[model samples]
Target: MSGDGIEILRLGARGDGVAADGLHVPGALPGERVRVGPAEERRGVRRAALDAVLAPSPDRVAPFCPYFGTCGGCAIQHLAPEPYAAWKRGLVVTALSRAGIDAPVAPLRDAHGAGRRRATFHVRRIDGRAEAGFMAARSHALVAIDHCPITEPPLHRAPEVARALARPLGGGGKPLDVQATATAGGLDVDVRGHGPADARARQALVALAGDLDLARLSLHGEVLVQRRPPVVPAGRAPLVPPPGGFLQATRLGEAMLADLVVAGVGEAKRVADLFSGAGAFSLRLAETRAVHAVEGDAGALAALDRAARATPGLRAVTHERRDLFRRPLLAPELDRFDAVVFDPPRAGAEAQAARLAEATVPVVVGVSCDAGTFARDAGLLLAGGYRLAEVVPLDQFRHSPHVELVGVFRREGRRRR
Candidate 1:
């Protein structure tokens, strides 16, 4: 609570209010319309209430999805497109500031709601019928819909095809993660496995692949068959991902990330790339830089090695399939590096981050898809005497709450503060 002129309610990073009197108000996450009392009523428990402005600061328009309030897929669709992009950029700067890092922030371009190559929709049997759509925003109940504009045409076909197959998903079926990519061969479907659709269900599954003209087929957790893309000079990096292997669903997004990672390393001669999956960043970086990639997936590494052998300039890339969670690279072994880059999963890197703080690397770049976890790991780097320099947020998942950001961190000068 401030002086007699104006009272401060809940202090926010952007000087906003979370709530005034514990009443539930909606609109915009990390946003609240705070109450400002007149000079006369400065004292007391600050128990005043005022109408909260939940709009996107005059920068956002109402969302298009009717199930926006109930669907878990999107969080910011309600925002005006321009303002939504601005808010995301601020999120990146704010995250970097939290890490005590201040560098040049870059403008995010092409922030649109298109080119979604991958999507996952829920499958449910409604009234003894297979219906496909997202769930209610806060509930697991299905909002059966045939088409999702955000998804690519082929991926959107998943729901209708599911209904045609009428596959029985045991226990009402669970969430299905369907990934797709546009390549020279055509659109490919990478269906991530889900619940068991019994023997009767298998018939329905096959019908889906055939009806949709899918270039690839996959069961729960398996890739049945994939239409191989034309092999350009894949460089010494393996691009043949195993059935469940993690491949960049979007080529454009992956290229941007890989470029940022390579630039972040500065003049790194020998660097360690952690959580290196199928050399997404590692192999790309290896085109010019030397890398010792660390990951837990042996199969993924095997594929990457196979790619490396085929690549001409891949002599610089090496990999070790180690469980960094159980055992991280020791400081002595890592002390020789000039820079480091890590693109960890949603969990972020807790143990690995701690070990990185003490490492002798100069520049460290961490790419994260999860904001909260990025903030957490950035905090660790800040404590380790690294200055958060730059953060670039990518709205790869449009109309959704998810944000992908890349932050470049630099080691502070060796002066004890």
Candidate 2:
């Protein structure tokens, strides 16, 4: 512990304040003098807990959420809007600079419309009753809450629903994860962590779903009860996503990303949507151009196919179930599409990027939630003769360190090889 408070130099990737000596202080803002306890090294970085803020930064503001500090869900709720946007945008700029890719990074766009539509609440038996809420910051300890303010208004009751759902599976005995998604029909919930539910547990869950008037309830993707299909609208199509399916955190975030993707595709007659999840982009793109949606998840692909077939007036929407990581679409396979749009997981589409690098795809749009991985993949594309056009950063996960980005690339001349 330093007798004199340490000065915070900058914000780290994980929203922690970094001192000049490389000490990472949690809950400390840049340009602020913060007193921290003795540092301990974790994951190669020396970290300390912020004990006091001797001098507060101008960018610091009072957090709106009462549970902001205790809950692990949000990191930078105290930062003012201007500096917060700059910091979020800087994430993409810093990442691209580190990757040695010189590109025009746009300002941060707020896509957190109506807040997050989906949230995962951790359920555990505390004292005598089942409690549902988020985990404490940097700890496994649960912070029970009545509701989360950052979520959509409909999902404010998600914590209560999660608590009720956990009661059937021996609420006090085992820990459970309740993933709730606000859909058109109603709340779609999926419970995990508990093993296979027995006949009695299944009956209890089904009854509870009926009582709660839930759209659907599932255990590990297996439907326990479905009062109605959990439909989520993507553009003009109504999609019933698979149980525990991956979706953009916010409805507006999906639309924003899809808009960027469609605009990047331009006048392309054929497009390939790689790593497409439940046709978030494919169904939308299919309205104008022929789309070939490729994904590893069969359930997601099936949902996309069903939605596409049910919706009229959409151009041909073909799909394929392929593990892109294991076997990326080769150069020859990619030749048929005029443009390629890939929105991979946090790991990014390194293998697909390699293949796209070899291919002569006129236009390529890469959407990623991880800036570091996006920058790395952009480097591969740039090395393969693709000119980095523009990069847009979107803040969908408000008050959090996570930022989504969409990068546009165009093939210039020939490949380096």
Which has the greatest TM-score? 2
lDDT of 2 by residue, 92-128 (tens): 9999999998999999999999999999999988998
- Taking all chains together, the TM-score of candidate 1 against the true structure is 0.77
Which 10-residue window in model 2 sums to the lowest lDDT? 408-417
Residue-level lDDT of model 1, residues 151-221, one tens digit each, is 65655676665454345444235545444444344445554445455566666566566666655555654
Q: What is the C-alpha RMSD of each candidate to the true structure, in Å?
A: 6.9, 1.5
Q: Against the true structure, what is each candidate's TM-score? A: 0.77, 0.98
Query: lDDT scores for all predictions?
Result: 0.63, 0.94
Runs with alpha carbons beyond 4 Å of true place in candidate 2: 415-417
Model 1 lDDT at residue 214? 57
Model 1 residue 330 lDDT score: 67
The 10-residue segment of model 1 with minimum total lDDT is 38-47
lDDT of 1: 0.63
